[model samples]
Target: MNAITHNTVPTYQRISVKPLAVHIGAEISGVDLSRPLASEEIAEIRAALLQWKVIFFRDQHLSHAQHVAFGKQFGDLTLGHPVFGYEPGHPEVYSVGRDRFKSRFDGARLVRPWTGWHTDVTAAINPPAASILRGVVIPPYGGDTQWTNLVAAYHGLSPALRAFVDTLQGEHKFTPPEGNKARQEFVSKVAATPLISHHPLVRVHPETGEKALYVSPSFLKNIVGLHPRESEQLLALLFEHVVRPEYTVRFKWEEGSLAFWDNRSTAHLAPVDIYDTEFERQLYRITLVGDVPVGPDGKPSVSIEGEPVAAHSVE
Candidate 1:
């Protein structure tokens, strides 16, 4: 693969957003999400995602089909969880509602915990490449999503820290039995379809060739070759480091808005702030398929805790 150079920045038209990145992310105006995008427009959006890693479009009146169509322009759509069905005719789209699920940290009884920082589907063998989230019904205040630039996060790490991480691997699972019983039971029913898998401590971006920290507080279980207590401490430290606010951007949602992010180079968290209200918050998400992960080294990456297989390494 060719090295990603600073000169490789792609072209994009900007919307009237307060902050503008050099090319990291942009808001596009003058386009309606409910309508079909022209070939050129879709091409530009795809290129922008490869270049910027995240894109936001506001005031989209998209139906399930329209949302799926937008996602398909970038790549093949991965079906939502086999067990959890999507809205009819939109198998790729998954619904998130506050009525059924609750955020784990905030004790918000209806919101889902995906608001925690994580890349989409990191526990899967082939994690999602990108995700498109459409805000259906947003609260008047207190629910926002924050995204961190993993490339920037990795670049900010001390060289010694990066070197140390390069030598390590982590176990990832939906939930572990060791956690709270209710949490474990919920995850086991909704998230525990498979055993744990291991991934490299560092991941190389598929398109950018930039290195990023890949572990998340939600799915990452333990480090290989370390005692349980030692692994927990180390993981806790790393998780805190990865979510530092310096490398992050927060986006407050509005009804009919959509946010698309590259899973390969970003980690995100949803905030659960609304509680004990009659308000209903809902969102729909579509995930695109991705290739196997690779590491910075030019060798195929192997998981540490389980059987190692020849796979595309992040290099």
Candidate 2:
């Protein structure tokens, strides 16, 4: 259960909240990024994440190590990615930038990597519970990210549909970004692992006990029990509804800004407008490992291609 913070009591106050959207996002002010956080501060931050699915910070520029430190206060951190490589000597920090991608795929025709919304690592049995991303370089215009509240999406569905989906499961596959097959940065980063996993269609959030629609356009392949035509139709209907404007909030990025989101309750879209241009945008991400997702029926997710994330402590 979430511990409530009292406005009358001043002892627990340290951070200020400026909501970015009515439903899903908030901008947290008054915390220093360069230094360690107090236990009280971490508590409020976690509470804020529970109240609002995603939170943001402005002008709190953080180094790679600082980013990881902030994420550690939440829970055990995961390697940057299951198959995607991270910066040398810092396996916890996944580097995302234009120059970095170009260096890896020298002569390939590159396009914007994100056109859809997704959770951090749904292909694994234990996808990331949450993530902290810091913007190192920002483009002048047209590089903004958005997140949707799956909890809201699930509630928006009709009663009959909700009951029907509650008993179903879906497959999430780790495929490369569209347009370039074997030439994509992610596919060639490591030996291609056929990462696949089955998760409940409606996941029960371990923290808040909220049931969120656990579907994404990027990783979801099909509904497990339905026919091929039925599966595609169901997926298409849910996918279109998940990103409706009422359930989402968009963030305009600036250098030194950071966004922390609950991957278990939200799905995000990477900016695709800056493709085929001179503009460059870069960011660093740290993912916190989470428990396997449980459906409304109380079944835990299972993996096929990789091992589940185990808990760990690191400085």
- If scored against the real structure, what TM-score would every candidate get? 0.81, 0.89
User: What C-alpha lDDT values do all the predictions have?
Assistant: 0.67, 0.81
Which structure among the candidates has the greatest lDDT?
2
Query: Model 2, which residues run further than 4 Å from truth?
Result: 1-12, 99-115, 177-180, 184-192, 311-315
What shift in Å separates residue 221 of candidate 2 from its native position after superposition? 0.4
Q: What is the lDDT of residue 27 in candidate 1?
A: 74
Q: Model 1: per-residue lDDT, tens digit, 122-224?
A: 7665567788999989989877888877777777789998998877777765652233334434554545355356677788776767787877666777887
